[model samples]
Target: METVMGNGNGQATSGGRAANAPHSDLVLPYGDQRNDGVVQVSFTLPVAAGPLAEEAARQTMKLMGLEDPQVAEATAIGEEFTFFVGYGKLTRAVELSKLRVAAPMWEELDQAAVNQLVQDTLGRPMVVVGAATGSDAHTVGLDAILNYKGFAGNRGLEAYSAFKVVNMGSQVPNEELVAKARELGADAILVSQVVTERNVHLANLTNLVELLEAEGLRDQVVLVVGGPRITHALAIELGYDAGFGPSTRPQDVASYLAQEVSRRMLN
Candidate 1:
């Protein structure tokens, strides 16, 4: 993706343009530097929708180093609350090259390798139970990961020769998921939640962890959560082994599961 990074004066470390020049179409040299001067900011503050509110929003943008901030749109989210979409040019650029995120990085193996790994490591097929738990009705994300066909260009977990994946579909309750895991002797539990409104997903995730802890299955099974807003930090806080957010690839999940299972066996 193309990105632009610059200082307040339009001067940037990027091999090109001023930090604030109208706009620059340059792909960030590094992941950290790719600050595509675009953002979808939303805020709810107690203010009336008027010139004063617009000015306040613009001022907020300026304070954030957004030059010539423009209030593109404004509306009322609820009683005594106002929302604004401010547009502006950012003066700061990120040093993309300095970023070092911890994540699985490996080429995906074919069906044969997967099957061989399962047979050699687990002495049988690796069983994984997945579901879109909580009140979330969206099944597309879970289906994309657990179904054999997969999503995008990546193959789903079920397509792996070594994996015996069972997708329980969506809207599964926590207790039911736990029961299913126990019944199926699942080695891993993959939970997906896409809805975040009112923090319902958080409650659901927390409950699942509690259930696992109560059942003495917390350490025995690899617990993973994924969603549009889920993060590794949040997952860890909720007692999950790992958390995945939007744009997570199937190979990434598969590699992590394979490595983690192997690691656990050693201990």
Candidate 2:
């Protein structure tokens, strides 16, 4: 792969061909670049489309320490307001290589190993109840993890011989999920939320945790929450045993769930 410089402006100096490198050979441009605090942000201002609106957008970016902000796109949103999309070169980049994030560190284990461990230790299948709880009606995420066929070439929880997985589908109320878990003698409860607008998912997730704690089931079951925006740190802070984010593979959840179950049993 050949490397080309990006014009001090955001555009690539060479043709588009120079920027589209294959993932295997791609190199970081900021490998040794110093960190700067300048940043670029884009949002719609509830103002008319004209010189004044453009000036307001630039001023907002300037306040955020962004220099030479350019309004790349603007559109009329309504009769009175316009939506503006801007791009600015941010002078900031964090030292990601030096950052440390705390999370569960478990050895990867396959479905067979996970099942065998459950049978050997718990003497029964690991019961799990999963649902896309709250007002979020998306079921694809939960189905991908609980169904037997699975996603991305890895088998899901239903494929494990020692795992009894029940998927309750989407838009399930939190009270119903807790009731089902108790009825099924579940060892773990997996909650999926995809609708995040207005932090609705956050409130729903917190509500589930609060409900489980009220019912004295918070510690009895491994409570895991997953979504496109959910992070492990966010989940831990929200009183979950673990959190899986977008692009998470089936084996990642399986490995974590199996290890958590075993750990709980031992304790």
Candidate 3:
């Protein structure tokens, strides 16, 4: 029933928009009814689970600009921790057209096309060195992109004749990955890691870049990173050429490598 100035686009002055307003990319959280702006949120507080804790949760939601915050449940997790679930009506709308999202612009190619492109451009299989660098022992993400079996019914780079994949499994040091990439004359290097608390992987990913730069291989190799926590924007911010997040298929990586290597060689 009320409106406020919102973030992004600056046109979202109506979290609960008028019933007859012309729709032009304005959006809000929907719950029981259209334009209701109802949202559910769950969070844990350091206070003990009691009436005070429940009230604190409601107050927190109100502080977040939620109207009519209704605390649904409060449970104790530990000696001094309480978890609360609540419903609230947000009073801010977002203009979708003004949102800036960072993503890669590349043409999708199938396995056959990728293979043909590699053949036509390099006249040899593209060497790809992949590993789960640092103390991150997660290999499921790396294996899905580099292994022959692939993931989600799509064949990985190993199955593509265009790519010669050397998958160095989990817990590999950044030094080892760089060395392996150099030893094999890899055209691309993929590092996978699970992002941890305080973004511990940030140091490791940056360290890898530093190593590559020091080795005189940064410009020659296409550096890519992947994991559940990885994003194209984040990877680039960390000095990687590309980044793959969860649900990315092997074909996506292969196509990028094929096109990137081809483009570099051509230029």
Candidate 4:
């Protein structure tokens, strides 16, 4: 496969990679491994579904650099709105070899290992206080990690033998979370923020960190945040010890907490 250079605008330049490369260097859109450059996209338009609306959708896709744009499906949404699914050929090929992402540093552990680590290292039950704080009322992420039922078939922190989990549910205040953690002598603090409207989660998360710092408890506990938009890098940037993203299993959190608590205690 030939190597390709992107212009920083996602457009490939004339270049070549190693001819005997083990993996693909440049890749185009593939439908059923046909490599037809076929692309499917869906969007909504203000106009109602009709002949003009279909043309507008096609033209919009064309304007975005798609070739042979076709409005495969169109539906009228309420009165003045129309939704469309379009298919076209993408002209550019992406260089997968050039991609990079922030990688996680924590090693995951199983249920037994996590429990044993806390018991052997800490010599006591690790207290954890978790909540979905601020005006964000979403508790799905918090419940999944703290609740006994867990998420994705993994047992939660409450089910672990070594961690005492305190779930504060939804709409908890930052100050209250800090107070509760202090009151419980928590070894870890987990915050879940699902509502990112206008970057409200950022402010809410930052406020919690600031509150902990003000209370002189910021370095006393393992702090973690989780949400669909949350990333490890973002969590560290917001002064969190770690961040768990969507589809995180309970063992993932339990392992991190056990290791982090032990590390902090030893340090």
Best by lDDT: 3
The sequence of per-residue lDDT tens digits that candidate 4 reaches over residues 187-239 is 88989999899999998999999999999999888889999999876887888
* CA lDDT of each prediction against the hidden true structure: 0.75, 0.77, 0.85, 0.83
Worst 10 residues of 4 by lDDT: 1-10
**For candidate 2, lDDT tens digit of each residue in 78-172?**
86677777755555443333433544435578878888888886899889999998888898888888899888888888889878889999999
Candidate 3 lDDT, tens digit per residue, 175-247? 8888899899999999998756688899999999999999999999989999998887788888987888889
Off by over 4 Å in 4: 1-22, 265-267
Per-prediction TM-score to the true structure, in the order listed: 0.71, 0.71, 0.84, 0.85
Q: For candidate 4, report its TM-score.
A: 0.85
Q: List the residue pairs that clash in candidate 2.
A: none
Order candidates by lDDT, high to low. 3, 4, 2, 1
Error of 3 at 252 (Å): 1.9
Judging by TM-score against the true structure, name the best candidate. 4
Reference-based lDDT, residue 73, model 3:
87
Model 2 C-alpha lDDT versus the unseen true structure: 0.77
lDDT of 2 at 230: 88
